[model samples]
Target: MSAPITVHRPSPTGGRRVTVNGAIVGLAHDDRDLAEFLRRAGLFDAETILDDPRWVEWRGGRAHHYEAA
Candidate 1:
């Protein structure tokens, strides 16, 4: 409904924290991969996630996986 909010955590801590409306939604851990952080945060939307390797072959496939859960 609105633009995504990004909470940046930098320095010795070496990571970022992302939240929605002050809720502890996700941690952009420096040690961990960004993708994992996003997945854990449940940020990726099915409509936007694309399988670039085979997008044409997999039309709407991402929606199926995301919707299944």
Candidate 2:
């Protein structure tokens, strides 16, 4: 199986960093940006990505501002 995707919010200005298998994919400014990045990378569909456990782990089980489109 592919390595799990990782989302990180390092700094308020740094935006969200998306990584897969230790490779940096993109730095997103918001939910839409993140979705776009994932779409472009063809890693996961928006719905699946939003529902992924990795997102919950990264966000401490809290809901983020981004929603699936």
Candidate 3:
């Protein structure tokens, strides 16, 4: 099965669209923002799982990337 969290590609202005369980969470400009989004989603250990493939899927570019190329 796919991960529950999905960090989409960066937009033209910056920041990536974050989703939890296929629902829109918010826009994250950096890793800190991503953590906060996850925290709000009830994942208290958001920071530690950012790099864990079982928790998140970084699309388009890569993890922590918030700039469109």
Q: Which candidate gets the maximum lDDT versus the true structure?
A: 3
Rate residue 30 of model 3 by lDDT: 92
Each model's total of backbone clashes: 0, 0, 0
lDDT of 1 by residue, 9-59 (tens): 442434445444345555444323334544565646422432333221222
Model 3 over residues 1-69: C-alpha lDDT tens digits?
Answer: 999999998998999999999999999999999999999999999999999999999998877889865
Cα shift from native, residue 22, model 1 (Å)? 2.2
What is the Cα root-mean-square deviation between model 2 and the actual structure?
Answer: 5.3
Model 3 quality (TM-score): 0.95
Off by over 4 Å in 3: none
Best by TM-score: 3
Q: Against the unseen true structure, what C-alpha lDDT does each candidate score? A: 0.38, 0.59, 0.94
Q: Of the pair 1 and 2, which is ahead by TM-score?
A: 2
Query: Which 10 consecutive positions of candidate 2 have the poorest summed lDDT?
Result: 60-69
Q: List TM-score per model, in order.
A: 0.35, 0.62, 0.95
Which of 2 and 3 is ahead in TM-score? 3
Q: What's the ranking of the predictions by lDDT, best on top?
A: 3, 2, 1
Off by over 4 Å in 1: 30-42, 46-69
RMSD of each: 12.9, 5.3, 0.8
Query: After superposition, which runs of candidate 2 have C-alpha atoms over 4 Å from their true positions?
Result: 1-3, 12-14, 54-69
**Residue 17 displacement in candidate 3 (angstroms):** 0.1
Clashing pairs in 3: none
